[model samples]
Target: MRILLVGAGLSGAVIGRTLAQAGHDCHVIDSRDHAGGNCHTERDAATGVMMHVYGPHIFHTDDAEVWDYVNRFADFLPFQNRVKTTSRGAVYSLPVNLLTINQFFRRTLRPDEARAFLECQADTSIADPQNFEEQALRFVGPDLYEAFFKGYTEKQWGCDPRNLPASILRRLPVRFNYDDNYFFHRFQGMPREGYTAMIRAILDHPGIATDLNTPYDPAMAGQYDHVFWSGPLDGFFGYRLGRLGYRTLDFERFDYDGDYQGCAVMNYGDREVPYTRITEHKHFSPWETHERSVCYREFSRAAGPDDIPYYPIRLVREKALLEDYVRLAQATPGVTFVGRLGTYRYLDMDVTIREALDTGRDFLARAAQGRSPAAFVHAPL
Candidate 1:
């Protein structure tokens, strides 16, 4: 079988490798000059520091299969994400942990004391929360919400919290304990070399051929038995219906003599601050020592035509537009949509890999049975 895979990100690389290993000819293409999509990383020429060109991507997952799968391609260094945020004038721990709560209030409270204090502070008036603001008010109350989430949410999403969905805030936890590890996953680490190298290893199968800097042409689909598209859902159809909403990031890069910021990531919760967060690239790979450091200040805004789409804005309007694309995708034959952009959802590295693996296995199974697979392995709508 000849398979056409678009977008040489994790999804494309994983699927291409899986199909190639099964003796199928796979051709993977990416518009960018390099593979690994948003997870692309390379060493800085001047400083010799491993720089996460897009942003810092800390691999953390509870799935043992996904953990084992990535380890087969590249060596992973144990890494734990400890995020920090600055609100008003003081820096504090993220995820609203016990230390953060105590530091913000200027009080030393134990776990139980902190829990009870937060309960008292919570607004009892709101029985059922409607949006992000209401959820925060009901759980953490106005004072903590304003100090920690309000300004930050406004800056990050470029919208009022009241208009956003509550599910977004629900993803974050308000812990009563002092543990500040950003993610509660069994496996948390980063590739020692870089994501690009790991993906290159994945695509190195004998049956796989790769072409970078090649744009997708719909007519090419006729040449292959199957097509797996990991590009933007709207883009595949030439945006005939309308463009889906997405928030893209702009990074302002600067090099420093020594460590610029002590930590890897620092979020500015105050709306007055222009950039949302500052990431010291050298801190991402602490095992490597470098005299000079590289850092980026990230600014998020609405994605334009030429801008690279980062975060999908799945608000009311965008959701409706996505549904139209989903219907068109379902009607299209010999094509299957996969990954974050294809599904129009915010997915972590693990989920993307897991889904790709499953999609590839399903395709092989269907081929053996002499049957055509559905348009999507995981439904976008």
Candidate 2:
């Protein structure tokens, strides 16, 4: 079987490698010049500092199979992301932990008192929260919500929190403990050689051919026995239902001697501020020490035609638009939509790889029985 894998990201790479190893000729293509997609990393030519070109991606997952699978390609050093935030000229621990609560209120409340106080603070009227702002108010209260989430959420999504869905704020947690590990994933680490090396290893099979800076054409569908697409679902159909909502980021780079932000990520939650988060890339690689640190101030906005899409805005309107694309995808045969862009949801690198592995295995199983691979490995929209 000749397999055409679109987008050389983790999903595409995993699928291509799996099919190739199964004695199928696999051809992988990516619009970007690199293989890792948004997870691509490289060393700065001048300072030798490691750089995450699209943004910082910390590989963390609880799935043992996914963790071990990635470790086979590159060594991963244990890393716990301790995030921080600044608002109204004050700095606080992120994820709204015990330390943050104590510092923000200027009182050392015990765990019991803190819990009671928060319950009192939360808005009871917002029983059925509709949007991000309402959800924040119900979960945390006006002061904290305004200081921590309102502005930051608006900046991140390029819209008012009231207009955004409640689901967007659901991922954020208000911890009762002092632990500030950021993620609850069992396995959390940074790849020793960066993500690019890990992806390159995944697609290094002799039977897999990767063509960087190559675009996928609908006309080429007849040339391949099967296709695994990781590109934008709407893009596959030429945006017939209009481009689904996406948030893109712009990174402004800077260099400073010693630590810049004293942490990997620092959120500025004040509405007056333009950029949402400041990422000190040097902090990501704790193993290597550089006297001069490199940083990026991230500005999030609606994704334009030429911009790289980062976050998906799964609002009501976009969901409807996505449904139209999914219907079209179901009708279109010989192509399988996989990964974040194809499925129209945000996914960590670990989940993407795990799904790709499962997709590839299923594809091989279907082929062995003389059946066409699915139009979607996982449900889209």
Candidate 3:
């Protein structure tokens, strides 16, 4: 079977490699000049520092299979995400941990004491929180919400916290302990060489062929036995119904002679601060040292038609629109929508790979049974 895999990102690479190994001829294509999509990493010509081309991507997951899958391709060095946030003219550890609670209040409280204090601070009146603001106020309390979440939420989402869903606040967990590690995933690390190098290794299969800088043509679909569309869901249909809401990022790139923020990522929790976070790429690879560093100040906004979509704005309007697109995709034949953009959800690197692997196996099994492959391996909604 000659399978067409769209977008040479992780989804395409992993899925293509899987199918290829199963004796299916796979051809991968991407609009970008290089593979790996947003996870693309390249070396700085000046400093020889590895720069995360789009933005910083930290690989972390609890799934051992996903962890082992990536490690098989590249050497992953142990790296933990220690995120710091600048708020109220002071630097504080993120996740609103005991250290942060103590530092903000100017008191050295123990873990249990801090938890009790936060519970008292939290608004117990709101039995069921509906939006991001209410969720924050109920969990972290008013003071911490205003200091750490409110301003940052407004800037990042480009709207009032009340407008956003409560699920958004769930990702930013508040800790009772002093542990400041952003993610509590069992496996956490970065590819030693770079994500691009790792992806290239993944694509290095005899049955797979990758074509970068090549956009998908509607005519090409008829030529393949099956198509795995990893591009935007609405995009596949030419957005005839409507465009799905997505928040794109604008990065202000800067360089420094030595270390700048002394960390990989620094979040600006002040509304006055134009950008959301500052990512020091050098800090991403702590295993290698470089005198010079590269950084990006990320500013999030509504993604225009020409812009590259990052975070999906799955608000009321977009959800309705996405439903229409899903119906159309389900009605279509010989195509499977897979991965983040295709499924219209923000997925971590590990989740993306896990789904891709799952999708490939499912497709093969379906083909063997002489049955049609699913339009979606996972529901978009």
Query: Each model's TM-score?
Result: 0.99, 0.98, 0.99
Instruction: Kindly report which residue stretches of model 2 are placed more than 4 angstroms away from their true locations once superposed.
Output: none
Checking candidate 1 for backbone clashes, the offending pairs are: none
To one decimal, what is the Cα RMSD in angstroms of model 3 from the true structure?
Answer: 0.7
Give one digit per residue, the lDDT tens place, for model 1 in 25-70: 9999998999999999998899999989999999999999999999
lDDT (Cα atoms) of all candidates against the true structure: 0.93, 0.90, 0.94
| lDDT per residue as tens, model 3, 245-293 | 9999999999999999999999999999999999999999998989998
Predicted model with the maximum lDDT: 3
Lowest-sum lDDT 10-residue window in model 2: 372-381
Whichever of 1 and 2 has more lDDT, that candidate is 1
- Locate the minimum summed-lDDT window of 10 residues in model 1: 372-381
Per-residue lDDT over 187-243 for candidate 2, one digit per residue giving the tens place of the 0 to 100 score: 999998899999999999999999999998888778998888898988888887799
Cα RMSD to native, each candidate? Answer: 0.8, 1.1, 0.7
* TM-score (C-alpha) between model 3 and the true structure: 0.99
Q: Would you list the rank order by lDDT, best first?
A: 3, 1, 2
